[model samples]
Target: MGLAIGWTDAGIARLLLPGDTPADMRQRLGQAGGSEKHDGQPELAARIAAYSEGARDSFRDITLDLDGVPEMNRRIYRHIRELEWGETTTYGAIARWLGDVAMSRAVGAAMGANPIPLIVPCHRVLAADGRTGGFSSPRGVRAKMEMLALEKAASPNGQFSFGF
Candidate 1:
């Protein structure tokens, strides 16, 4: 499976998995951009492919076009985007970091609304008391747990392993 990235002269507008067509993702996210074939940016596609294959430790320094996302959700995503590989944070913690402990569900909503899945790393967000929380991606929590396992497997000392 390959990655499809929507872009304009500005930057990457949206990122989607091979399961959905770029046209579908653009329409779903209300994004504005022309899509280039995977060959157009072989390096990026390769990086994404490597990550999907569970051969890469982390996706570093990738840019996303978040212009269409809501402001509150943007704020929440910004905080978790910095989460290092093999690390996870709770929805409640993120809501608290945003200065409203009561926004835990709101945080969950933002995670569900996340358009750029792996790039934004929404799987790294968990439920309170270390639950798996919910995942909007295909395969749901299984996908999230698989990603966590991939990272855990690649970690230097396996310190990332945390039982649920």
Candidate 2:
């Protein structure tokens, strides 16, 4: 597993999760037009590393640079960022929060397009049937499950329930 993060003056701009080779991470970052420099966010990097090791950090206070993202997607990401550790929600629920349950697919699309996965907490969003749904990380749904498991393990009671 390899992790890479890209930061901008505004905040973190992109994150490549564990599971890719270093070369793959570099190429992906380059393709996303993010600089390969890892010098900007030492504290954040440390937090992320701790998170990968199953430490609890809601990360809600972290700022993100969603400059090119559409307004709807931004809204979706904001809502997702409010989800606490070990909490999970359905795409349909988020769609309804957006004022239309029919927008479930749209919510899924927004999750897929999210550049900052862990901070945005896209893995917390599930399918209406309680399925893991899609995760765009290199490890795909497996990575999503791993993150959820980590959060669950970090919970105070070592337990969590699905919502909506």
Candidate 3:
């Protein structure tokens, strides 16, 4: 698996997960107005690598460049970023926190549109019924589940179980 990240002067702007070939990743990065050779933030890259290797590294301190993100999505991303390793939340729970259960779909949409996935931790959001919801990664739900498993994430009831 290959991973690529893009950053702006503000902070990290994008993260491309595995599933694309190295060449494809480079092409995508180029299309996104970035060069594959830009390693502007090596420390952040190291942290991401450590986390991917099963370390409990937290990205809470890392800054993000969300210049064009909608206000609502920014709010949701902030909330999701607070979730620690091994913790999980439901889309409905996030919606309720936003003061409306009806916004569950909106929360899901925001998660889907998230530019930074692992760093923002959108995979931590599950379905209201406790099932793994949609993940925008190319690997989809499988990738989301893998991330949960990596964190040994607990269910909403506080019991650890990846079976969900």
RMSD of each: 4.5, 3.9, 2.4
Per-residue error for 115 in candidate 1, Å, reads: 1.1
| Per-structure clash totals for the candidates | 0, 0, 0
lDDT of 3: 0.85
Per-residue lDDT over 1-164 for candidate 3, one digit per residue giving the tens place of the 0 to 100 score: 47889888798888988887889888887887777666477787788788888999669988899988999999999999999897899999999999999999999899999888999999999875567878877788888888898999876765433353
Off by over 4 Å in 2: 153-164
What TM-score goes with each of the models?
A: 0.77, 0.90, 0.90
Report the lDDT tens digits of candidate 1 across residue range 83-102. 88878888888988999899
lDDT of each: 0.72, 0.84, 0.85
Q: Tens digit of lDDT per residue, candidate 2, span 81-127?
A: 99888888888899889999899999989999999999999998887
- For model 3, which pairs clash? none
Better of 1 and 2 by TM-score: 2
